[model samples]
Target chain A: MTTVLHSRLLNDVLRDILSPYDLPPVEDVTTRRQLARTLLSGQDNGSFNGLALAYAVVAFCTSTEDGATEVLAAVGDNADVLVLDGVRGGYLLLPCAQDQHVGLARALHDRLGSDVWMAVAWASRRDLASARATAEDVLRIASCRAPGVYELRNVLADFAVLRQPHVAERLARMIEPVVAQQPLLDSLRAFISEDGNRAAAARRLDIHRSTLDHRLRLVERLTGCRPTSPRALLTLSVALTAHSTPQVPLPRAY
Target chain B: MGRGQPVLFDVGRLLHEEFLAVYRAAAADADGWEDAAVSVARRVGSRLISAKVPVAQVVVALRSTDRLLTEAMLDDGGDARALAAAGTALAAELMSAFCAGDDDGLADALLAGSAPDGAAAVYTVALVRGALADRVVNAFRRHGPVLLATSGHLLLPVPEAAALPLCRDVCAELGGEVWFSVAERPAARVALARKEVDEIDALVTSLGRPPGVYRIDDMLFESAVLDTPEVRDELDKVVAPLLANPVLVQTVLALLEADGNRAVAVRKLFIHRSTIDYRLWQIEQLTGLSPVNPRDLALLGTAIGLSRTNALG
Candidate 1:
């Protein structure tokens, strides 16, 4: 039942994604449209990368052995991942981008059933989070829909953690202060985006550090929270993440 | 023939398409997308599996719809004007899912147990993914223990033949008796969810012994030495002296492995041939068996193999 809950949730997202036009988007039609576009772009790139990551992906054809002439190359060294089916059931080398490579793992799993052993390498910090999120998302959502599809037994986590709505609701509260104080909010956003360097923040805003400080103080006063406080910092961080995250078009759950 | 099962063992398409399809179906609901997807997936999967269609065919169908739905989900990210541009984000999700071996596309539904004959089993459901033969054979082989990855489980379309041999070999090596059956993909799955539906399990149990449909076998090594207690004791007595002296035992075993060839034995033990000779001579003195003798060499080799196997295990 709980598994089905995850399936249902995924269905809602799929429906909205498939039928983006169904949701009325008066406030941010452009925003909604961009959201839909990114998902498509991501899908295209994902398939290529997904193929690369699969425990059972297509091996390259031989166009190798000669450097200057060949339509295709079957060089093992250039391949993204190496899958080994030896030490009993199976094993796989997951070619993952440190920061840039995204969504390859989950796609591979969904494409294959659950009997996969993967060794993933994240190329960057950004990818680390996405990879981890993707792994989590698979566990949470895979079986929720297809009970016997693949063999991912009972390792699903809370999908709300990755769901934008839950993040939006929580973040909405956090962003209220920014909404309450527009100028200071914009300045702070830039400052944080620029990585908390007061000089950079001020330079971006064409203001003195003292002025930036004073504005930040105004923000603290308005929201009863200081930028330095852990809670405030967390809220700000989450807000930035939420802001940056693509709005996935999800249908209104009936 | 001993190796590949393409459609059934695809770990990727199984999750992606299924998850995506469910997501699409449930996305329209007010409940969380998580809830909606899970609900839809389970509902559809349950119906499809229970509908009596061959499990493999059903899997293949799920893969296509899953991919289509997921493409739609990722499509959400394409709208740059939306609250947040999600193309990159959704793309990232899709990619990561693939890497995670959750690519449950349309092909998987048609893997195991031939397509069942009936309209109910052939509900024109959304398609997901279909894996190639070679790829799946390798996937199952590489993923060692399904239990190691608690996050997910595995569904393999093992030929009643190959799997049985493997199970027998493993049981023999593992020093235990193990029994398994085809698990009636559709029934075992549903039954596993219930308190293990007895009738299905019973049917499986009965079928398990039938030499074909669902099968179970064992590999038991009968010991000639253990046929009689005196012979067993004699064998044990000889092993005890060697066990008490690991150095002499190892030296003797190494020498025997080399077939009494001192140079080979020395190389294997990574020791001087003179040291090996000395140990060999000491073993002879203690065991009262000449290292050069054929009877002693055979006995030493067998004993060493048994000892090493037991110790390692």
Candidate 2:
């Protein structure tokens, strides 16, 4: 028999046998392990021919108890979509064009609420594992920002910083003095939020323009980096983001 | 280096040790020196003021120490740039200490050219206050050093000829009322200059002159009136009737701010010219002080200023 025909026959037999009784939810540890084994077996035996096509792997975090089931339901009768449970959240494998990943993630994000953080990456059948890994990496880096849908492109800078922890550490050390001074740190944040407009930053901080200048000067004196200079400002800005982001590693992808 | 000045000696010793510490930290690890250097610099700066070291002497000492350290590092094939950078950080911290009123000597040194690169010898002192004091101070800093004193007062030193125009530009750019006083003083006597400016500021505040740069000479009339206790009461009585109507009061104040230009005052109030004309008429009928008459306008401006001050109090 052809591989596609054989896989279809096996899937139909399994569905017919399991359709008679309610199966355990995917949240059950044994059931999840069984499903993982079955998927791995399918990869080995070519039981799921759909896995051979290009797909978008999405990794997401959800606090709700039935998050796995909810995600599956959100994916909603899409024969090409596959869901896998992981330690913190779960993964969705959608066999679709690369350009559709963001729209799909956005739809999932809307369904899952703003509290969910999701990341997407594209891969072919053979690269599914690496795609899952990339999605998880993007998710970890983008988690520092507001929880929402993210892709590698959306978090390239943070991913760059995240990859070289030593550089991040040095950048973070540069702002250690600023981090200690609340008013100076607040001023820097306001200056950045105002897109480097001194008058607007002053208004935001409710301080005089001179006072903002003094505080920024103090920040430069402490960090050896001028907040007004483009290179130095980028260094300070990235350093602050890195410093505030938690450094813990994410759990391994399934 | 006398027994009476042990604190100064300690400051010198601490600065020396910290510079060495910074060099060693930099040599041992590139990233380790910043925190150690910054904390040590701040501590040494605070000690420099607490010891009451003369600002000029402190400048000389810091520069001498930096040169000596840099030269020693050069001889040893170490990073002289790191040592020099640490010194700059130390000086910046000391400037901060001076701004915080660590010592009068330090403040004087900052105003005067303790360092060869300090401000000019005969700079004019400007005391700036208001909602835009910070913006004005920052703008003034382009010309010279700006020292932020207690109670949000900014002491700026600029050339005498540049003072009025600079203040005008700041007020125009910032679009807010910033009351400031400018007094020409020798750099050595900025503290005294600040007091004189403060007095002029007080007199101007009492007279309720429109927000702009003021000199003591410009406020001679207001000063003469402020000296009499009954004059304020009399001035208050002159505009009290106009004050009862907030709209008329606003129109009179706007006219004064616009220098008796009704068109400009109408633009400021965002009202029709006829409305402003009617309001000014109402003000004149109520207070017997015509906004159109220069002398009457002056009296009305003073009354409004005193009334605003009283309301604030």
Candidate 3:
């Protein structure tokens, strides 16, 4: 069994745990003090006892308000859990069996249906110091993918591979020289997609095989990469994906 | 002071919520309990100001909180006069913070393109003839426009259906030429709309077109050509021979702008109708494409549009 509290409620409980009455002055004293003040003025006046408030993964969350509460209540009713309150949503603090939590998340998803987007994070109880960081990381990774229960390890690896700085810079440096030549760029994209098949790429571009070959030659001269090479093909394919993909903006700040 | 009673009530309600939380801390044996309440008040004041709640409404909310705190103190058998003095002091601190927050919110709104979220269309106004920017802006606001940003290029959020009528009214009111474009898209997409607006405005300016509501969607082909440099370059090459002669370029441009109406081109250029017809024939002889034919007119219009608008991207 483990002890955990809701992540959002941490900002509130942090005030009480790190108040001037409870702890010595620390490095982020000003920020702690501000939080403590906000907590004092907030409407949550409930008290806590006995349970050790530690970190836990948010296995799933929904967008709607009542749906979230119903799911939280249902999860609490079925399992030995604490349904902690959050300002915008609720969190489930599971004390035992991580599988039981995942099971509950799945059952909740079934109930909420596919319309609502759910999120999950990779967090551990022992990593209390990095709880907020873990939660934010999961949220960022989740934003890039579709709505579902996200497994953090795989998502993190995928994100790291796709977003490596040098990979992006190399792709851009090669593709920048051909951006203005729409027809050549289109042909290059088709050729890369068809696995460097000249016949297939020509059909896709609706051009003659000779025309496609000529375009490939021009592309090689422009980007300094041969389309026929496997390693070069992967880079070109990934480059086209990166070029065409629209970057979703972060959520607006108040 | 500019806020209504409902807004004041909203401020009071939110302040009360925060006050209860502060009261809980103060009632406990926590150190800095009194300072905590002051901090809470300041934070709440700042939030109200940032939300664009009026200063007077914030003052009313603070006063209401003070009254509630005073009543609670008396109920707890605290000295009434002492509580009153502390309440007055707290009120003064909160009011000062609230005013400071109001100023900060104004600055932030100016820096960010802060507006109500339901803005459906984006309008960019580029004032050309006179210093009538304020008058044009006030008219848009009167018709429920949310001013997103202003840097000479005024970005506003307006409804799509209301855009043309509103633009027509403003153009009539100002009584002078001002370049404008309306992009009937979501407000969040205004960055793209800004580019479209700039292109349309540039197109109007280069054509020496009179003040009117120019929808960005009207010049769909021209806009596409403008965004693609290679396509524009090709079109420029196609029209290069005619462009070499400034008079012929002007004649084709005038004819295209007049929508192939020779009489209209004649009137616009202050030349005889026969001269326009002769120029059209000369244009055909030079390029092997007559402006009088529908298919040839479109091709010629695109080429001329590319050559005429040097300001296009």
Candidate 4:
């Protein structure tokens, strides 16, 4: 507790930094704060302390309109960690152990019947400045994970743990590729689905498999390839999970 | 005015817009007392919109009450009759809303109607009283929607309909602007206004409420093949008229039921030959229908059955 970044300080700093993005007025922030406080205050009731770990904070919710209203409905039950990541066209807040974010992502996908991204805290450094340095390291592993899925999570978390400027620059880079590649990847995914198999992918594409293969080869073949070795499948999986756009997998035979 | 689309309202936006709306409505009023009312309306409207229910129709209901107040304040002749007329109109609107569906609009309506200065408030009283009396009441039966906008009330439409002129008329008197929002929504009828009631100094103004309220059972029975547009149009032309001469229509129906046998249906209807024949002629002229075609005969039978059935009952 002594070595770790202080909660009050971190809360103050993050609240200040994110102040500009708060468009619904300070009232919304106030309401959220009050709600968090109320939830935290009922520690004796066990509902509040039941959800959080000793040094961790967690808040999560599900938009019940997705035809799966029952998932995570019980107020008392909660996962060890909580974070938000993009899913389908919107976003979802996920909860589980940092280790279980992967499983929770899978469960969320199952419940909502959609792919979703997960951003877990790999580490929480003392200062925002130092946290940003740590984020740069994790984000470099960005190629192995879905692009913006964890970067924003990492930046937000790191900024939560440490008040460094690095979170912003790194987050800016993280969101740029996601926003850019979204449409291209979206089109490519549709083409793959409609094409059925990769062989069919070529015939309908009016191109040889070699051309299509060359494109896929590039996803793993690039020089700064975080997803290059043993990580190619992992990277593609994260990308697909972050968004429901299924990758044109190497089609297996019957 | 731009297009027939409802102003999108979530809880946050609804509250914001409602407050803004109240601010504007209060500002629009040359008189300042209505600001308090506008404030309440703003709050309630915000909550309803956040719940994401279609309550645009509610605006009009409140405005109707406001218009009545304005008209009364004009100190015009028959002011009592005008206010009474407004009350009936508001009542009728609330009744229509309740009868049409399970009321998700009640909270906003109750809050708005709680005020007592104007027509909207009075209508709310009428509406609450009416809803309490008959659970399965008609549309616009309850009165709260009108009271919310009793002060400087403008005839603002909710669903895709033209607002009542009374709202604009009263608004004019109060030096307020009547901003009518006509949303081009698909579910409701277009440009449809509330029922008209001729004033009789509060002595039971018969609100010519919408005539098409069909209960579930009524709809189910009307689901017969004759309800098809082709058959329905024919009946609307033919059957709507014969509701007058029950004996004549019945005799004609009996004759048709008996396959146009003058002898057998005469016994069926206990009518004279010439009487049946005369009614048959009227039926032919009105329906443009001959008893000869099988389709026309089936249509007649079905229409007669449906028309004779008490829809409200």
Candidate 5:
């Protein structure tokens, strides 16, 4: 079906799904995500011609019908496909096995070549209601990747919370006491970001593992939350997301 | 029954009837009558006050005769001039009333959580994005007679019947890109409803969810907590570790977004379940909070929300 046709159908399904929530029917992308979440929890449709696939991959690529068709064709008969429009260009949904993900993405890019640039993000019954939400994130992180098959995992680091203004303010303040100890904060950030991989975080920071440990201890002393602990790191990660945000402007005198 | 008392009674009765007639007539169609009515009332009310007429006595006299006066005015068959004059008398009596009953009614409704029987419903409108702010404000003004604003949100005190229509009109006029939230409280108490609307607005925004009119009950706990600076700061510390690795932070957020359903977080993040496990482990290792644990998950969810709120903004 055409992207518009699929989107309309999806919107109808979403509305039906969201009706229980009693939210005013505002047809916006954000609302769409909300509805999609409800569906992701297990709204069934025989139209996909399968009970469920291991994965649902979404792609934002060239708008041309031929480009989209070629991309879908490259996914082979193993998957069910749909295209959604009324957004940034067009979107493609291909539900397939995790095993087929890499091969399909590669084939599509190979066939479309430079004629189409593709950004892919995948979802599953476990977490994603639809690949629609992650497509943008994938597209954004796609910039750091060369033209080829790129899963969201490969470039997950590219998506930081600190990039938001309000968040950054809160985070900066949360760590304000320790912020002056630049080295310590830096070590903690690297350690957490590297998924607590001491060697990796040390390498990224160009510090010895022992020094990283020392800095981490300092972080513990300041925040009362050790850097190496999951619970503490979780808090630290949230605070770090704040760093990307632009400084909050003066509060408006309402 | 005394000779002088009888004459005085007749004059008072006639004046009271006249005042009631004008009031009923003007109320039937109040257009262009307020100025005349208020002026006449103020003149007469002040005069009576100056003449040592007790405000209570004047109000009681007006109240006792209101029904009879209204009946006479109705019998006049839409006589605008007489109606206008009666409105003036009524206004005078109203002014002389010992207290502002209507203001008191409003105050009662505003102060109470549940609206009193006659209180109108008030709503708080939050403008999330500024693009259609003017149009939305204008739309509310056009449809609702009373619009109150304080600090952040627009307070619309709408008649019961006007409530739904005003909401529909704004939605239709602005189109969907406009981000906003609407929640109703007692018209007098709409200012207090600001918290509800603000929470919903922040919740929806943090979730990267769509804009719509929402009730206070629609707000999610995670969204509400993250929206608060104090709570967000505390939660920020919990998730601060993952911030350096944006990807990992995103993973925790996805997990939190999925309510700690590892499989779901993996899907939202578009990563493998194995990857989700690894990240969850990393998160658990660094924070001593297991994604699988309900309490730990809630904490992580809060941190995720706090992060998303910032990132989305």
Candidate 6:
């Protein structure tokens, strides 16, 4: 009887340890504030090597009022992840090493389903605030990607262009005239997507080869960027990307 | 005070006449009088702001001044550049005073320029449009002043904590069709916040998201993928052939809209199950993408969204 009771107690403890939802949420405002302060101040907290921050936005088919709750529950107790209230969703902080960041993000994505866009960043406790900002930037640059886990490294080039919004705006304007010409825009998009295989592009558009050539020439004439040249193609491609990217205009002082 | 009124009126008249005179002089001489014209315009701007005149009225007055100056300069065959320069100087000084001299405190300061004093507080900037914008403006006025931006958009600034609930309540009260684009920023960056919210609205609208509240954070994926011309191009290509056959296109859209449930799509399309099956197969054959597959369905959904936006244009 004694041996059986001990065995049963051991099983119960193991169950608590293995369960992802074992850790109750940090519900007290004061406790959460203290935790945030401690993590942000870079004090040596024995539980974590670094903080992995994942900022996400979830669009629900229904009302989004409970989005934060859903996101928090989805994050669960995995690696002592803490969910803080944010704009549309929540900020999830995982106390883990660098190598586990991607896996943690993936797990969150799986739990949250397809409607969530998340960007993850790993930083030392000292850089926690900056990491959060970086996560936001990652979200912006990777906004075009399918809903999943994204990192700054994956979107560095796009982020670089977006950082200098004026340059990006100018690049976008370079293709403004082309945007109005649907046929030309379509041709350019097709040609680029087809890797400059004119014949393949023509087939994709279901247009004659000569007609495709005419459209390409019109694109070049209007945009001053030759489609057939490799260097100009790179410019055109970046311009197209910039044209679609949202820009934050500089503030004006009266 | 009564005697001062006519004196002010005479000063205004004298200033107007002097502006015309200087414009005429500069048109011919192209020197010396330009500075005088600028100085006179600056004084006029200061006087207008001091009188607490509305910016719109000031703009109208300036337009009339510009027309008169232009006519006078034209009659004298004056250099058009000189008249333009003077007009710009007048406009600049008026705008500067209108922004800087406003006594309405934080709202006015943020609208005119950044405010370091308000930097400690985070503001949620809301941009609303459509017929509902008026109602929203009326509702938002209880919290703070609402700025009327161009194109009938209303800009409302509220505290960060109160923003979400307030916007949600407003949206609910007005119904789900009402949409608001909101951005949270520090007081010093409210100007950029306006643009940020506007961009969010534009992006989400283009993606065919239902009318509701949207923020930059909520629109990351849609802005990243649906707005990217390259991705749209690729997706458009996938559906281009299907577009030639409206029946097939409709069938595919129905399937996507139904979330790939064949029975639901069949009911929605008012077609038999076999018909939807055949169309799905046809779509797959034409686009080399299967609608039954989850991954392929997402791509097709985005492709159709792009197609619809393009068609609307």
Name the candidate that leads on lDDT: 2
Q: What are the models' TM-scores? A: 0.27, 0.37, 0.36, 0.19, 0.31, 0.36
Predicted structure with the largest TM-score when compared to the true one: 2
Across B1-313, the per-residue lDDT of candidate 5 in tens digits comes to 0111111233356447445434654747756555555544544443342233334456566655655565666676655565545644565545632122222233334434444433433544443453444566556544432222334355444422344455656776777666656666655555556666777677766655445554433333344354444346545665677666777666765665564556666677777778777877887776656666544554565566567778867
RMSD of 5: 21.0
Which residue ranges in model 1 land beyond 4 Å of their true spot? A1-254, B1-27, B39-67, B70-231, B243-246, B257-259, B267-282, B288-290, B293-295, B301-313
lDDT of 6 by residue, B1-313 (tens): 1112122243335446657766676677656775665566555544443343445555666677778777777777777887777767666654553433222243445644476332224557777644365577666544333444444444443454557777777777666466788887766777777777877877656655557777664444344454455445545666799888989877766765565668988999899888888888998898877676533554565566667778866
How many clashes show up in model 1?
187
Off by over 4 Å in 6: A1-254, B1-113, B116-120, B141-156, B159-161, B226-229, B308-313
Over A90-148, each residue of candidate 3 has an lDDT whose tens digit, in order, gives 33434323333344345556665433333443233344223333333444455444665
- Order the candidates by lDDT, highest first: 2, 6, 3, 5, 1, 4
User: What TM-score did chain B of candidate 4 earn?
Assistant: 0.26
lDDT (tens digit, per residue) of candidate 2 on B59-93: 67777777777677667776666766766766776
Candidate 1, B1-313: lDDT as tens digits:
2133233334335545446534543434324544444344444443332232243454355456445654575566422222122222333343332222223322222332233221122211110012332333234333221100111222332323443355344334333222333322331232231212222223333222212222110100012221223333334546566667888776766655554567977898889867877887877766555555433544554444444444544
Question: What's the CA error at residue A184 for candidate 4, in Å?
Answer: 9.7
Docking class of 3: incorrect
Per-residue CA lDDT of model 4 for A1-254, tens digit only, reads 01112333454334334442432232344443342333333222433322222222221222233322332232113322222111212122222223443343434434443222323232222122222232333333332334233432322211221222232233333323433554334333433344224565566667776665655454433322222121222223223323331222111111
| Candidate 5, superposed: residue stretches over 4 Å from native | A1-254, B1-131, B137-152, B156-184, B199-237, B255-273, B292-298, B307-313
lDDT of 5 by residue, A39-122 (tens): 344453423222233344455455355655565455433213433432223444444444455555565577664445455654
> Which residues of candidate 4, in runs, are more than 4 Å off?
A1-51, A54-101, A104-110, A114-116, A122-206, A209-254, B1-313
Interface RMSD of 4: 33.0
Candidate 6: tens digits of C-alpha lDDT, residues A83-171: 45444544555654444566657765676633566777766556666666556666655556556777654554355445555656766
- The alpha-carbon lDDT assigned to residue A218 of candidate 4 equals 47
TM-score of chain A of 1: 0.37
Per-residue lDDT of model 4, residues B1-313, tens digit only: 1223343444334333333333333333334424344344434543333232444455553555455444544443434443444334433443343233223333233334222121121121111111222321212223212212222111222321222233333233333221221112111211111111101101111111112211111112123222233334435556676666677556655655565456888888777878767777777676655443323433455456555442522
In lDDT terms, how accurate is model 1?
0.37
